[model samples]
Target: MNKAFKYSYVSDFLNLPEPYSEGELQKGLLRQMKDFILELGGDFLFIDQE
Candidate 1:
């Protein structure tokens, strides 16, 4: 089967000011976890220490 999936995500909420690192981007996304899940079509869960 040839299926496609997004290994990563992009969202306005994750847009940092500038000069940021990958960790910063991730933190931003987690900070807005609710919206992030919705952005992912509301089919996501936040499991800590993943």
Candidate 2:
């Protein structure tokens, strides 16, 4: 049988403080996610502008 998986949007996982610049939030979130995946020993492939 084939297995299916789901992926989450990065924005949804991030809980940023209000009044933050969008650029800043995006950069912070990406860094956070990268660290988390690394810590978990999971592989990550980023596809920007998807």
Candidate 3:
């Protein structure tokens, strides 16, 4: 059997909602995602837009 563990900070971050319009939220998410990829050594690639 496998046990699950959770981080409170990650939970809190995940629970946050986008504080903007749909398009704005999408833009923000995309920007953050790109930053995340780059921060993780720039080896990630986004293959889809939806």
Whose TM-score is greatest here? 3
Clashing pairs in 3: none
Considering every candidate listed, which one attains the maximal lDDT? 1
Clashes of each: 0, 0, 0
Tens digits of per-residue lDDT, candidate 3, 1-50, equal 33454432232333336454667656666766776776787577765556
Residues 1-50 of candidate 2: C-alpha lDDT, one tens digit per residue: 33443553346446666656878677877877766766765466544521
Alpha-carbon runs more than 4 Å astray in model 1: 1-11, 34-49
Q: For model 2, what is the error of residue 44's alpha carbon versus the real structure, in angstroms, after optimal superposition?
A: 5.4
lDDT, residue 20, model 1: 80
List RMSD in Å for every model shown: 7.4, 8.8, 6.3
Q: Return the TM-score for each candidate structure.
A: 0.39, 0.44, 0.47
User: If candidate 1 were superposed on the true structure by all CA atoms, what would the RMSD be?
Assistant: 7.4
| Count of clashing pairs, candidate 2 | 0
lDDT of 1: 0.67
